[model samples]
Target: MGTLLSGRARAHPRELARFVRLFTVVRREIEYALRPTGDLLHRLALETEFSDFAFLQTVDTRFRQGEPLSDAWDAAVLALQTEKLLKTEEIALIQAFCSAFGSTDPAGQSANCAYFIDRLSELQKGAAEAAGKKSRLYLALGVLGGVFAVLILL
Candidate 1:
């Protein structure tokens, strides 16, 4: 899942927006009709069109197989980290989310999800800005290098 998204993100900077949308949907779904975490994950696994569908499915499966939600979420996040798909800030946000998730009442869990979603959205914006700046910097460097080469030739 992260594999596919990482590659796609390289080609389309808006890929992280998909992740934002995913979290928003999760928040909305849970808030609409609170259910058990495992059941919520199972439903998201079936309904989500995001690249993290596999991650959600794996967590749901592991939870059903007797793993704790935090443990399953940790394992899944670790797998995503190994793929290098997440930034350091994003990783910290996700870890915080896992720690708080399932340890609270349904309302609290929903609020936790909302908090993380907002944090993730902010990180996404920063990343997009950084990517844009780096692209412009690289473009300027390329142009400068071309001009220098032409001057040297003359």
Candidate 2:
């Protein structure tokens, strides 16, 4: 009986649509967050809190048009520090960027990344839990209706 009801519940069009929408939103957000070479330099300049890097200044020059800062400084710091062959001045610039924009040094960026990732994971988990609950509710409703029909016939 449970298996039969589960099959019927899975066939519901509305539940399928909701699942698809949830998946699409999660995919888009994750892709945006993980993209390589996102507009970090542009963001740093506009935010103006961490525009000390000379390379960032050059990157700023290419953008003749107005653009909003979307990338966080913490992300940029992590990217720079991850590079193995960076010069002392380059490292210094990364530190400066972190200082201007981030709450802490390189460690702060790591912590921030961890925090954000954890939040994303939590959101995904919550969505899955909600979907499971909805599925269970639908299954229960179908099963109860079936039982009620049998009782009425008897």
Candidate 3:
């Protein structure tokens, strides 16, 4: 819904926030349950409807393989790099979100997730504004180009 309308691979603020909230909740659950990282990831995997389910699976596999959390996070972000549906800013935000899950400390991870949530909210507003203006400009340019070409042919 967001990428198509925005004419780029940008996530809607609301959609971005929804994932941020999921991360926050997961962070809290980790802190309270004192669970192993892989166990948590497996749990998340079972809840596979998230847009980033594949990413979560990657993280889970990385954890199971004894890879560093940061490494796992990087792998997930790397997968996102080639997606045409994501703008550079959206990728940057995703990188930031992944970084939060890298923290070994639950409190620290939760804090980072919260901070990025606020940042993404602001970005969403800016994306909406840019999309409206850019769409109009593109439309006007297209019409003008079409009319000029017809006149030249006449």
Candidate 4:
């Protein structure tokens, strides 16, 4: 009976590991799907604008019905869908990952998901800062050139 109980306990961990694996794949898919691209950002902005409109509509409805909070779920879902658009190749990659390791533990999966999300956010922030610096440098150079030209004329 002790041996049987030990086997059962081991099985639980194994099962949990499998669920975690599934969660990891799903999280990775979500990240890849939401990766920023020039075209993707443009589309996302449009979708965000639409989402705002939908949110307003929901809020208006809620106000009329004397509800405190709006029915914002639909708008949020729409926005999420828009931002999480996946390309064919990304979708295939995610599907393959899921097929191979779909049984990961939930706790492990959540940890992995959070790690990836944080990493992605950090990368995005770095990229944005770099872009902002470049823009500022270019603007300063343009202003200096304009001043130089005026001095030469004078």
Best by TM-score: 1
Worst 10 residues of 3 by lDDT: 1-10
lDDT of 2: 0.44
| Model 4 residue pairs with clashes | 16-105, 17-104, 17-105, 18-103, 18-104, 19-103, 19-104, 20-104, 20-105, 21-104
Clashes of 3: 3
Q: Could you tell me every candidate's TM-score relative to the true structure?
A: 0.71, 0.29, 0.60, 0.30
Backbone clashes under 3 angstroms, per model? 0, 0, 3, 10
Residue-level lDDT of model 1, residues 66-103, one tens digit each, is 99888888887787677675676677776777787667
- Best model number under lDDT: 1
lDDT of candidate 4 over 1-154, digit per residue (tens): 3333334434333322332343344455445564322223223334443344332344334434554321332343344345443223332332333232223554444455665445444444554465456556666666777788899999
lDDT of 3 by residue, 1-154 (tens): 2224445423444445455566666767766786766676667766745535666777777867898776877887687675444467876887776655645577776677677767766776776676667666666776777788899999
C-alpha local distance difference test of each model: 0.70, 0.44, 0.65, 0.41
lDDT, model 1: 0.70
Please give the RMSD of candidate 3 to the true structure. 4.6
In candidate 2, where is summed lDDT lowest over 10 consecutive residues?
14-23
Error of 1 at 59 (Å): 1.8
